[model samples]
Target: MSLNHVRPWKNIYRRTSRQIMVGNVPVGGDAPIAVQTMTNTDTADVAATVAQVQAAAEAGADIVRVSAPDAAATTALREIVRESPVPIVADIHFHYKRAIEAAEAGAACLRINPGNIGDEKRVKEVIRAAKDHGCSIRIGVNAGSLERHLLEQYGEPCPDAMVASALEHIRILEDNDFREYKVSVKASDVFLTAAAYQALADATDCPLHLGVTEAGGLVSGTIKSAIGLGNLLWMGIGDTIRVSLSADPVEEVKVGYEILKSLGLRHRGVNIISCPSCARQGFDVIKTVEALEKRLEHVKTPMSLSIIGCVVNGPGEALMTDVGFTGGGAGAGMVYLAGKQSHKMTNDQMIDHIVEQVEKKAAEIEAAEAASAEAAE
Candidate 1:
């Protein structure tokens, strides 16, 4: 394709409400779309919880949520909060006391499914405690369990019912003069969840936390979450997202970023554009792309790179990326840099050569960013 033929990138986005801070990282308003994950370890186990929290942080999770189920779990919060690399969210259920305990223990945020958390007075206490501790709250209303009155009114856990439930919870907090919070109305069913969130988005300006609850194991879960969250995000509905995979929490963070990237919302790491192999593939496309991906797993750059299997589509794709390789003729590949042909290398040298070039480009980018930061300072 010629330069003039290149299609202009159309804006496929709806303006998200706005960004709001969840701790330091912004969730909805104008903040970068944050990637959040939950710790599966027992929250009272300080070492394991801290380790998991740190692991999620190291794995690029912008925030980590852990369950504070009991008084012991609340006690562990102080230490866990002190050690967490990113702000910590305490997931409290049913127990208003635990919410207060978590708030006092230094949780940056508290996540509670308000429908199940009991009376208005208790809810008010939870809100007051959060206000006292400078903590935010998430009124996470789930489809699995809803307020009995709503269930009777709607007959089943429908989108309208869920939205109503979420509003009721939001009303409680707002009436109590507590406004520093986010909301999530998650349903195991993607359609229901997405619809509910869209409805809620209209009814409130509070930032939304997107997820497809009980999203099954890796493959199905990621797909469901992507489609559900991605659709809303494309419509400018979500502020922060959690890809609730039944796999490792780290994988959740990875998939969260992937969804954001697919929507052109954010890019945190190497965005590898690789083609599926055909007989035309001159090199081992799978192995090379996999190797490159694994090696650059920790490289936190927003640069796009292409690793194509064959020469036919390679050049076009490579030209669209910041850097890349085009495979052709046995054991040979051409490198593309800054949308132009840079050089050619043999198959065996591909990985090393690509890595070296990427490292150099990344360093240059980092240096430029540092210089910009210093100039701003």
Candidate 2:
């Protein structure tokens, strides 16, 4: 039984939206909310860009975006797309021609800022190119680049203005008889972004791509994105998400997955639950968790591990996790497997021992799943 069924408050009723394809990945209509990231590497550097895309994919990104700022970038995109482990989204700005080129270069989606992509005729051309290439479009409306007319009408970037801008772009695509698209109304301010997305959700049934744009470096960006995206996701508004951080694309992917995991919307690697160590700790809880995190990075199996410092709440927490370790006296801790007290280990050997146990448990889970699948087949 799922936790949501037993705990009603954990339930999230997602908004109904039309499904669109970004290559082979579905964006909405009951599909898993896809996590995405954009590469900071120069798109013209095919090797570097492909490496970044692969890294993000390994970290569980469903889609990766690369800037196609010029003809050279789009030219390089052909090879990047060919080599990418996940679908590639070409991020295009003012140049509609770049969008056209990107579509032809095997991009699964073209992320174009509608406000800056010239007049209706140019948009129509880009739409036609997207259709010809079986590529989807993303109408990216950012607060920093709202249409001049919209800014004049609203006096500033607000939720009303953002939704209006998105609607205008949606109409252009609809007018061109194109519907394979998603939309995002992003702002740096968390409140503004959340408000814009809420209004966008009510205004259209298109798949909404969520993000807080220019969200800052790793630490700041992760927190801002967690709050903004977490609220929207809890309200069941986003179809896909990107954690915009001024860090490596892989870090963004990791943060995106962590947000999804926390909401119980998605799960991938080990979910570590640890307490901040106090004097009550029998072992160096902080160092042990840090070491375990680094060691368990290669474990992609979805599971939970609790590294509690003391017995006060540790045993209770251990009962709910797949694998757990609770600190005790005499320089040792108790290990719990599958939510039951299993054994004990010295603090010095705990890190390596826990890593071995986690790997073994992951293998068991995978094997059981495979056996069940085979039986069904």
Candidate 3:
């Protein structure tokens, strides 16, 4: 491809204001889309907690959050924070002391819902410790556990109600001159969560941490998160996102990236476009696509790759993407690159051939981009 064919990828959306650091990772204000997940392991288990944090980091989490409910978990935070590959976020609920202990233990950030922490004096104490430790905080307000006063006043967890709750927490932080923080008002219902986030986005510039709270296991959770986070992301409303699935936290990271990729907001791994199985499908497309997706887990490039079941739509779909393969007769398929036929190969050869082509083409594209950037500079 020539320079004339290169189109600029401009993300014109208005990013939220405020700047907070989770270790070395910057959240909000034009930073790259950050991937975050919480560890499900017991926080008091030092070894287990450290292991899970490391696992999350290896799986590409930029920030790892762990719940510290007691004094033992508070003590464990020191070692966990020390050993973590990425920044550790100490998640504290209903306990202001744990937040202080987490900050003292060198946690990079603290996740606390201000309304749940109680009293102006206690809040200031946590904030003082956080400022002393140079740690950031996340004001995480959930609909299921909104303040009783706010709930009684609003009569329900509506969007306006959620926004009111978030603002109330924001006021608490602002009252103490604590600006190193982010906010999230999450509800289990997708539409309600999206609406709440949208309202908050309009009201303030704090980096909004997005999620569909208490979103259930694997399939259902993924769908709920995709719907809620995806909608807010499409409107340019989120900064860092966590897909709160009941499944493995790694899956949360994966789904978070997928939402970003789908919105053309960011790209991480393979972008696979495959057809739904039909009578015209010549090969095991469902199996092939699933296997290909799992196999290409580590390919982190902005490359569009397609796997098609039949020639009718395959070649055209492949042409529309960066690389693709279409089914052909007698256990064979045709591979297309940049919309042109590269070669015809056997069904078994399909995966390897497409992967090789993608890697090679990706290198070429990267080199071209570098050269263009240099010329511009």
lDDT of each: 0.86, 0.93, 0.85
Error of model 3, residue 69, in angstroms: 0.8
Q: In candidate 2, where is summed lDDT lowest over 10 consecutive residues?
A: 1-10
Q: Which residue pairs in candidate 3 collide?
A: none
In model 1, which regions exceed 4 Å deviation?
1-8, 12-19
Sliding window of 10 residues with minimal summed lDDT for model 3: 1-10
lDDT of 2 by residue, 16-43 (tens): 9999999999999999999999999989
The TM-scores, one per candidate, come to 0.96, 0.97, 0.92
Task: Give me candidate 2's TM-score against the actual structure.
Answer: 0.97
Q: Candidate 1 lDDT, tens digit per residue, 243-334?
A: 88889899999999888877777777778889999999989999998899888887886677889988789999987887789988968989
Give the Å shift of residue 120 in candidate 3: 1.2
What are the per-residue Cα lDDT tens digits for candidate 3 across 93-179? 999999999999999999998668887789889999999999999988898888888889999878888888788778878999989
Against the correct fold, how does model 3 do in TM-score? 0.92
In candidate 3, position 240 carries an lDDT of: 91
Error of 2 at 303 (Å): 0.4
lDDT-based ranking, best first?
A: 2, 1, 3
Pairs that collide in candidate 1 are: 18-28, 18-29, 19-28, 19-29, 19-30, 20-29
Which sections of candidate 3 miss by over 4 Å? 1-12, 365-377
Residue 32 CA displacement from its true place in model 2, Å = 0.8
